[model samples]
Target: MTTRAWVLHPDIQTNRDRKDPQPALEEAMALAHALPGLEVVGGEVVRLPKAHPGQLFGSGKLEELRQRLTDQEIGLVLIDGPVSPVQQRNLEKAWKTKLLDRTGLILEIFSDRARTREGVLQVEMAALSYQRTRLVRAWTHLERQRGGLGFVGGPGETQIEADRRAIDEQLTRLRRQLAKVVKTRELHRAARAKVPFPIIALVGYTNAGKSTLFNRLTGADVMAKDMLFATLDPTMRAVDLPSGRRVILSDTVGFISSLPTQLVAAFRATLEEVLAADLILHVRDISHDETEAQDADVRRILSDLGVDENTRVIEVWNKVDLLAEEEQLALIRQAERREDVVVVSALTGLGVEALLAEAEHTLDEVRMRKELILSFSSGKQRAWLYDQGVVEAEQQTDDGFVVTVNWTQGQARQFHEL
Candidate 1:
């Protein structure tokens, strides 16, 4: 049966990291909707000067919320912020409903959406870690009234301890499995390295049209949806640019503001593709009200992942079709002033050709230094290298010339063929 859930964004005034409650609540509701079998009956932003240690809400406010939840028959309460285990248990008891904090809710959505073996293992490990912290002593039902036999932790091993141990074992097992999966992934990455194609990674906040743009550019049937986190697994496809250069395009998991710490640690292996990319396209939902905030969040995550400061990044202003014509024109004009920005609508295919051309041009500008030995009989090829303006230095030898050249990949390929 579908669970009826109510979303709550606790607007703690004294909290240092408080966001605009309205948008936060909206995002929370969207997150709830993204998960399966949860019908969000209603949602609201509850104002508070501070949080209650025991119940998270003030006494009277707690009763009022409880009454309303009872009236609406809400079986679950989704809090839009972190809730301690004590507060969660107390609130659930008082409100007569199940509760999930922001981290827990995101974990649930990830658990439902994970498709690949590595993704599943990562989610499972994160969920186990989260569950470990929630095993409070208040639940007497989990505590053994009598002593245990000597086989377990001798004598008085409480069920809570046993449960914790079990979770720990599962986590250890998952880590082993994840290590194997990661090694296999590393092997595949190594294989791709030999293909001589520049890897371009598309990264951005969730639902920022990275997958749509990937599909548009590569004609790959990757899942593209309006919902948040529609793409979780890293997908790669070789796209042939108009310049006849093949480059690998990688669509990775989208980032979000205040991403769960467990997920960050778990998915770092998956995001290695971004680290390996020759160029990064930072996609943004230009129409979102919090677009700037979202951009900051993505950049912050990238920095946390150790992306180099000198990494070449092109800002892609996506979803231009959602804007007014005047707004679109203004954005286009603004983008034209910046060399690193591209305004395109992945949905309508507008400016997609320009994006491809820009990508090719950017790749072509990346120069690689090479040393070539040309036979005396191959003077035509030697002249061709000089014609390309790539011959940096040359030394005469008995049978050939040893030439040092700094050239783009395209130039290098052309030289090798000659």
Candidate 2:
């Protein structure tokens, strides 16, 4: 059964957040909808001079919201920001409804969407960490008496301490399991590194249409949806560029503003793909009202993930089909003035070819022209050059072949190794 929920974005007047409150509320509602069994019936931006540390609202406003929740029969209330454990318990008790803060709601969505074993384990670890923080006075049995003589004080572990210890032990086990999984992933990455194909990774805010673009470019049937966090596990496919050069394209989990710290730490392994990428496409929904903000958030997360400044990045202005014709034309013209930006519509296939052409050109810029002379005895190396399609021209000589090729430094190093 769907749980009826009300989403609220607290617009604290004294807060320094520059995001417009209405859009934040809408995003919160979208997050609620993203969860499989949540029915977000309503949402609103509640303005306050400041948040009360205990209940997060003034006494009168708290009572009013409590009455409203009761009258509307809302089973869950989602606050689109941080809520202390004490505040959460107090509000839940006063309103008689289950409460979920932004982090908790996002965790729930991730728990539902995670598919791969690694992703599932990461979500479990993050969820456990979040739950650990909420363990204060949350259960009725927290004070239950342990086995001991009535005349003497109880000697067994306190419930909260026991719960924390259990979580810690489980976390240790998960870390061990995660280490094995990460080792396997590292081996896979090493194998791919030997393939001599540059990796291009797609990154964007949630629902910005990265999967659609990935499917269109690679012809892979990855799930593409309008829902936030439609794809959680990292997916990769080999794509042949317009110039006949093949590259690996990776689609990663989308970023969101104020992403949970726990998730960021947990999903580091998955994001290593982006870190290793030869090029990154920062896709954006140009038609969205908060596109710039979303772009900033994505960039912030990328920096936090330790993506180097030297890594090549291209800005992909996506969802042009959602814009008016004139607006689309203007955007295209604007993009044309920039070297690192491409305007595209993944759904309509508009400018997709241009995108591919630009990607190929950008990648080619990193290659250096080199001439090599190989003897007939170097047949294996000669065949490898031909297989990679990097040899621009070859000429027969007295006892060898002179080969002219354009290749990246890594490819040159691999050739030397051969």
- What is the overall TM-score of model 2 with all chains considered together? 0.87
Model 1 poorest 10 in a row by lDDT? 138-147
lDDT of each: 0.90, 0.91
In model 2, the number of clashes is: 0
TM-scores, each model vs. reference: 0.87, 0.87
Give me the displacement of residue 233 in model 2, in angstroms: 0.5
Q: Give lDDT tens digits, candidate 1, residues 329-365.
A: 9999999999989999999999889988888888766
Clashing residue pairs, backbone N/CA/C < 3 A, model 1: none
In candidate 2, what are the lDDT values of residues 40-80, reduced to their tens digit?
Answer: 78988899999999999999999988888888889999999
